[model samples]
Target: MENYYVFIMMCILLILLPGPDTAIAIKNTISIGKTGGLQTMLGTCCALLIHTSAAVLGLSAIIVKSAILFSIFKYVGAVYLIYLGIKTLWGLRNKEVAVTDERKDEDKYGSKSCFKQGFLTNLLNPKVAVFFLTFLPQFVNPGQDTFLPFLLMGATYTGLTALWFIFYIYLLNQISAFMKRPRTQKVFEGITGIVLIGFGMKLALEKAQH
Candidate 1:
């Protein structure tokens, strides 16, 4: 029970810290509103399930043990993030003023694309897998019943992620009205792009501990 409490606290702290996941969630929220934000949140949660399952099954251990495999995943994640960032920045640079008629059309298209955008954005991110392998084991006691601990940890992480994303959706939705302006949208996209690139660089440079 005590361990569970500690695990919960740790998960909260980790979620509070800014990362690619949080940035992506916030950007999606600002760009497309609550539904889009929720979709991204669900997608991220699905990725977490995959990571947790891999960790529990000890596939994370194999990936962590093989330097080559680890590097491959790391580079793939880095490149994908960088690509997203560059694309966002490019979009910002090319943004044109929307006429009144075009604004309505954009809104229609935006609503429709929100889910797929959110889903693919998170689904393509490989760093999520690396994060699970690197971070989840810290609170785990190998001496304890390993499977139970892993299960508890996975549950804790999923809960924390859900709570955080829900809160983010609520808060961003309130501000989303103001963010509908062209300038606001461009600025948000630019910031998200820069942050994603930073995350990619950090992941690319991280060294594996033997």
Candidate 2:
């Protein structure tokens, strides 16, 4: 019981942390609109579902355990993160306007593309897989089957994530008009770009712990 409570608290705190996922949400919100943010959120949650299934099936364990596999997954994920960061920074460098009419992005990133964007962004990040593997086990009881507990815990975590991000999206929407200012837009993109690249480098350099 206490373990469950602790797990919930930790999950909430972790979800609140600003990371690549949060960066993606913010960037999408700033770029397109509320619809884009919602689609991104859906794609992100779907990816979490996939990660949970993979972890329950021991696929994440395989990736974590096999040094070669882990390296490949880690590097690919890292490169993707870095690519997004550089692309964002490069756009800013090239004087790309951060906030524009939705029509402009309609062709560049349609509604369907938003889903794919979020899906690929979350799917390629193996750190999320590693996180699910390492974090879920802490709450499992020793006497029971781990698989059941893992499923329930993963569901709980994912649900909490969805809940929090809904509020986050709402808050961003409330401020969208103000944040759309050109200066603020540049600052937002600049900060997100730096953070994404930093996370990429950190993920690339970090050693796996079994």
Q: Which candidate tops lDDT? A: 2
Tens digits of per-residue lDDT for model 1 on 1-210? 236677778788878988777777777787667876777788778767766787789877777777887787778777777877887788676567456654576467754455554455454445555666677667666666567677667777887888989998898888777887888888888999999888888878877654
lDDT score at residue 52, model 1, on the 0-100 scale:
78
Candidate 1: the clashing residue pairs are none
Off by over 4 Å in 2: 93-102
The Cα error of candidate 2 at residue 184, in Å, is 1.1
- Model 1, global lDDT: 0.73
lDDT of 2 by residue, 30-57 (tens): 7667787778788888989898999989
Q: Estimate each model's TM-score.
A: 0.84, 0.90
